[model samples]
Target: MRTQVCIIGGGPSGLLLSQLLDRAGIDTVVLERRSRDYVLSRIRAGVLESGTVGMLEKAGIATRAHAEGLPHTGTYLAVQNTGFRIDFDALIGKQVLVYGQTEVTRDLYDAREKADGIVVHELDGVELHDLDTDAPHVTYVKDGTTHRIDCDYVAGCDGFHGPSRQAIPKDVLTEYERVYPFGWLGVMADLPPVSHELIYANHPRGFALASMRSPTRSRYYIQAPVDDPLDKWTDDAFWDEFRRRLPHDSAEALITGPTIEKSIAPLRSYVADPMKWGRLFLVGDAAHIVPPTGAKGLNLAVSDVHYLFEALTSHYRDGDDHGIETYSQTALKRVWNAIRFSWWFTTTMHRFPGQEPFDQAIQDSELRNLQTSVNAQTVFSENYVGMPY
Candidate 1:
C-alpha cells in the first residue's frame, strides 16, 4: 500500500500529526506494535500548557478536556518547611490544565476514529529496513501475514527505541545524553490533590513533588536512589518519605489515598540533532526527552507536532518545501532550550548522595532565591507557564 506520509508509532505525536494532516486534505497511515487498548489506556502527561490547550481547542478536541480537566493558576516551591506560590497567571497572565495523558489518548482516539484520512494498524509491528533510498517502507505483520507500506515521506514518532532514528546511519547522527543518579518513585492516589497548586519541595533528604490528575485523584513523586528496587517502595514507605520531604504542615491528611499506581522513572535528558533526513521526520519523545521537573516532555511533543503540521501544510498548499526542509533545526532550537531547563531544574532541585555541605547549601540558596527574589520568580513563572511558540 501507499500514502502521502507513512508514520511510525501511533503515540500522541504520530496520531495527532495524522489527524491534523487529514483535516488538511492529506492522507497518512499510522503503524503501531501495541494494541489500541494499550495505547488508549496508557498513562501519559497530566499537565497541558496554555499553547497545547489552544491547539486542542482549534482541532475540536477540547469538549471533554474542558469539562474534565482541572485548571490551576500556578505552583509552589518549598524549602525548609516554608512554601511560596509562583502564580502562573500573576507571572505570565495564563493558567494550565491538569489532565492525564490517558484522557488525551482517549480524546485523540475518538478524533482519529471519526477522521477519514487517518489509519492506525494496532498490534501489528512495523520494521524499518531501509531509509536512505527514495522509497522508505515499513514492513509489518497484519492478520498473521506480512505486508509492506510505501509512502512519499516517513515520520518516526515511534520513540527512543523505534527504528526511525536507527535508520539514520549511526555515523551521521550525533547523540547527547545525561543519566541522573536517582529516579522518581511516583504514585497515583485516590485522594483529592493535597493543594490547589502543585508543590515542589527541596530538602536535605531529597526532592518531592505534589501534583494532581483531577479534583479527586492526586499524583505525587519523590526522589529515590537510582539503585532502589521497585519492591522497596511500598505505600507506607512512600508516605513516610513524602512526609519527611513535604514543606506543608498537613502531610498526614494530604497523603491519604488508596494508592492506585506506582512506578520508578529514572531521570535523564537526551537529544538527537537534525531531526529530519530526506523525506523522513521525527517528533515527540522520538526526537527528545526531558525530565519531569519542567513538565515539558508532553508539551514539547505537542509543540513539535504544531510546527511539523504547519510546515507540512505549507508544503502541500504552496508547493514550497522550504519549511519542511528546515523542520529539524527549527524544532531543535526549542528542544534544546527545554532540555537545558529540565537539566538545570533536575540538578538544582534533587540532592545527590555524598554531596558536600557547600553543594547542598547552593541548591538551598537557589530555592530560597526563587522564593524571595522577584526577578528569579519571574524566570520560574515564565518557564513554568511555557515559553512562546
Candidate 2:
C-alpha cells in the first residue's frame, strides 16, 4: 500500500488526524492492534477542552457531541467541608464541554468510515522502517499475512506502550516520568450526578472527584493506595467513602446506584522529549501523559494532533517544511505547561504518604489563594478551559 501518511493507531488522535487529512484531500491509512469493540470499551476522561472541541468541529465531527454533550461553565473545589466555585466563563468567557471520550472516538470512527478512509484493525507486530530516510514505511501482520505501507511520513499515535516510540533510537530519546504513590478508584453509575458541575475535593483521607458523563450518568473517584485491589472495593464501600469526602450538603444530596464500571487508575506524569524524529512524529499518548487531575490526558493528546495536523497539512498542501521542522519544539512548549498544571493540581489535592504539616499548610494556602484572588482563579480558569493551542 502507498499513502501520504501512515497513522499507527486508530484511537481518537489517529482517527482525528486521518479524518482531517482525508478532508484536506491527503491520502492516509490508520492501523490498530485491537478490535474496534475493544478500543471503544475503555472508559476515559470526558472533559473536553476548547481546543479539542474546535478540532472536532474542524474535522466536521462535532455535531453529535454538541447535541449530546453537557457544557460546564465552571467547576467546584473543596477543602475539607468548605467548597468554592471557579467560574471559567466569568473569568475567561469560555466553558468546557462534558463529552465522553468514547463518544468522541465513536464520532471520529463514523466519520472515517463514511468518507471511506483506510483503517486496519487487529494488526499485530506493527513495525516502522527507515524512518530517518526520505522513504518511510510501516509493516504489520494480520490474519497470518504480512503487509507493508509505504508513506511519506509516519504518525505514532499508538500510545505509550505502542511500537512507535520504541522505534526511535534509544540514544535520541530522553524520557521523564513520575509515578504517584496512589491511584484513583473510579466508579461509573447510572444515576444523576451529585452536582451539576464537577467537584474536586481534598479531604483528610485523600482526594475525591465527583464528575459525570451526562445528566443521568455519574462518574466518581477517590484516591487510594497504589496497590489497592479492585475486588476489595464493593459498591457500598465506594459510596461510603465517596460521601464522607464531600461537603455535608453534597454528601446528603448524593444519590447511590449500581455501578456500571469500576477501576483503579494510577496517576503519573510522563513525557518523551522531541515528539518528532525524521519522518516519524509521535502524537498523543505516544509523546506524553498527564494525570487526570486536571482532565488533561486526552486534551493533551488532541493538542498534539492539532499541532501535527497543521504541520502535515502545510507540508503537503503548500510545500512548507517550517512547521514540520519545528513540530517537536513547538508541541513540547505546550506539553510541559500542561504537565506542570496537572502535577501541581494532583499534588495539591491528594495526600502524600509522608506529607509534613507544612505541606498541608501550603496546600491550604494555595486553595485559599485561588478562592480569594481573581488572578489565581483566572489562572486556574485559563488552564482549565485550556491554554491556547
Candidate 3:
C-alpha cells in the first residue's frame, strides 16, 4: 500500500491528524494494535483547551462536542477549608469546554468512516524501516499475513509504549522524566456534580478534584499512594474521603452514589527532546507526558498535531519544507511550557511525602498570592486556557 503519511496509532492524535490530512487532499493510513472498542473504552481527561476545541472545528468533528459539551468559564481552588474561584473568562476572555476525550475520539472516528479514511486495527508486530532514508515504510502482521505500507513520512502516535519512539536511535534521543509520589484515585458516578465548575482542593490529607463528565455524570479524584490497590477502595469509602477534602459547603452539597467506574492513575511528567527524527515524527504521548493537575496531556497532544499538520501541509501543498525542518523546535517550545505549568500546578496542589513545613508554607503563600493578585490569577488562567498554538 502507498500513502502520503502512515500513522502508527489510531488514537485521537493519530485519527485527528489523519482526518485533517484527508480533508486537505492528502492520503494517509492509520494502524492500531487494538480493537476499536478497546480504544474507546479507556476513560480520560475531559477538559478541552481553546486550541483543541478550535482544531476539532477545523476538522469538522466538533458538531456533537459543541452541542453536548459544557462551557466552563472558571474553576475553584480550595485551601484551609475555604474555596476561591479563578474566572478564566473574566481574566482572559476565554473558557474551556468540558468534553470527554472518549466523545472526541468517537466524533473523529465517525468523520473518518464517513470520509472513507483508512484505519487498520488489531494488527501486531508493527515495524518501521528506513526512517532516516528518503523512502520510509511500515510493516505489520494482520490475520496471520504480513503487509507493508510505503509512505513519504511516518507519524508516531502510538503513545508512550508504542514502537515508533523506540525506532529512534538512542544516541540521537534524550528523555527527561519525573514521577510524582502519589496517584489519583478517580471515581465516576451517575449523579449531579457537587459544583457547576471543577473544584481543586488542597486538603490536610492530600489533594482532591471535583469534576464531571456531564451535568448528570460526575467524576471525582483524591490523591493516594501510588501502589494503592483498587480493591482497597469501596464506593462508600471513596466518597467519604473525597468529601473530607473539600470545603464544608461543598461537602454538604455533594451527592453520594454507587460508582460506575473507578481507577488509580499515577502522575508523571515526561518529555523526549526533538520530536522529529528524519521522516518519522512523534505526536502526543509518544513525545511527552504532563502531570494531569493542569489538564495539559490531551491538549498538548492537540498542539503537537497542530504543528505537525501545518508542517506536513506546507511540505505537500506549497513545496515548503521550512515547517518540517523546524517541527521539533517549534513543538518543543510549547511542550516545555505546558510541562512546566503542570509541574508547578501539581506541586502547589498536592502534599508530597516527607514535605517540609517550609514547603507547605510556600504552597500556602502561592495560593494566597493567586487569590490576592490579579496578575497571578491571569497567569494561571492563561496557562489553564492554554498557550497560543
Tens digit of per-residue lDDT, candidate 1, span 192-303: 8888778888888889999988878888999998678878988988988898888757475574746888888888899987798777788888878888996899889888
Which lDDT value does model 3 have at 216? 100
* Model 1 quality (TM-score): 0.96
For candidate 3, lDDT tens digit of each residue in 292-371?
Answer: 89799999999999999999999999999999999999999999999999999999999999988888888888999999
Q: In model 1, what lDDT does residue 130 have?
A: 55
Candidate 2 residue 214 C-alpha distance from true site, Å = 0.7
Weakest lDDT window of 10 consecutive positions for candidate 3 = 356-365
Q: Distance (Å) between predicted and true CA of 198, model 2?
A: 0.4
**Each prediction's Cα lDDT score?**
0.82, 0.94, 0.95
RMSD of 2: 0.7
> On lDDT, who's better, 2 or 3?
3
Cα RMSD for candidates in order: 1.6, 0.7, 0.6
